[model samples]
Target: MVFFKKIVLMSAVLALAGLTGCATKSDKAGYAENVVYHVNDSVVAGAAMNNIKNHLNANPQAKIVLVTHGKGIDFLLEGAMDDKGNPYNVRVQELKAKGVTFDVCNNTLVGRKIDPKTVLPEAVIVPSGVAEVAKLQSQKNFAYVKP
Candidate 1:
């Protein structure tokens, strides 16, 4: 009787462990499938862009969009370079090649007295940065991230 009870307890424990392992694997797979990143800082924009690139490489069908406004617009400004002195235009182009879309806010341009033509050619101008963020969240269901 003692040996039979020990076997039953061990079986229950093993069953629970197996279920937990399956749950963890499913979570990881879900994470890789639907991942969105939002970049709102100029200083760390490069790192965020790099992360997007890595995600795209891992999941070729991933959808990626970057929203820049306020001070973040500095990352896509014409002639703006990173800390390494590499032109931001080059980085934007590379990321574009990997299927990343960059959205620029018109409010920032007006507030800063910057001409739209002065920004990267690939950037799309939106009505307002804050509103645009809201629209993306509500309509498109894009994940908001500030790196």
Candidate 2:
């Protein structure tokens, strides 16, 4: 019985490995993939920006979409700042210039009672950030990253 159980476990592991291997081969290169970066918290917004910048630097042809909701949308607002008072618009604009798309959740704005006019012009207001992330990953084959 023990030997049979071991064989079953090994088979399961091998099957999973095969699936993972096949999944990773979707892109010609790691950085050349369509990527969606999810940001639900403002605390990591700065780090997310850096990560997107690094991704673009590594692969200029890569397509990157940043989906923001909840507190994460704070960074994309006009005149937004970090803990140190560094303005976020400059970095956001720089990334935008490099072809990074920023998406803000309209659901978040309605739920939080934030004015849509307050959002920066650069960001596209999606109906739902989570749904947008899902659509990118499932329908668009975008690799998901949360940094």
Candidate 3:
């Protein structure tokens, strides 16, 4: 019985290894996919971050730009807090290191009266968030996402 169990475990391990090998092959360097994530509402902030993480994990070379306007910019504020009372800085830093960019709308800053210095370091101020998203999609052929 012990010998049979050992063989089964080894067989399972080998099967998993084979599957991993196939997965790694598909993960080989491929064409870079450009995408722009449009964030206009604060509701989807967490989900958007998760989507970005999954996107990069599946395609490490993907070019991602996160555009924020209005309430969506809350997540990129220096001392912003999520609904759960968690700060977004850690996740922002993590994604930034992985080449993700956070674009904040200048119009929002002025309209909302948020100080420029309060913006997170991972973010760059843009003339307009909506315009930036459109430019990325139209000019650069970047895929658009609203999550």
Best by lDDT: 2
Q: Can you write out model 3's per-residue Cα lDDT over 1-147, one digit (the tens) per residue?
A: 999999999999999999877765346665578999999987898999999999998889899999999999988988887888899999999999999999999999999999989999889999999899989999999999988
Q: Taking the tens digit of each residue's C-alpha lDDT, what string does model 1 give over 1-147?
A: 999999999999999999877764324532434334555669888898888877776666666778888888898888898998989888799888867888888988998899999889888888877787787788877767766
Please report, in order, the local distance difference test score of every candidate based on alpha carbons. 0.79, 0.92, 0.91
Estimate the TM-score of every prediction: 0.76, 0.79, 0.79
Candidate 3: which stretches are off by over 4 Å? Answer: 1-29
What lDDT does candidate 2 reach at residue 19? 80
Residue lDDT tens for model 2, 1-147: 999999999999999999878864435444466999999998999999999998877677889999999999999998899999999998989999988999999999999999999999889999999999999999999999999
Residue 131, model 2: Cα distance from true site in angstroms? 0.4
Off by over 4 Å in 1: 1-36
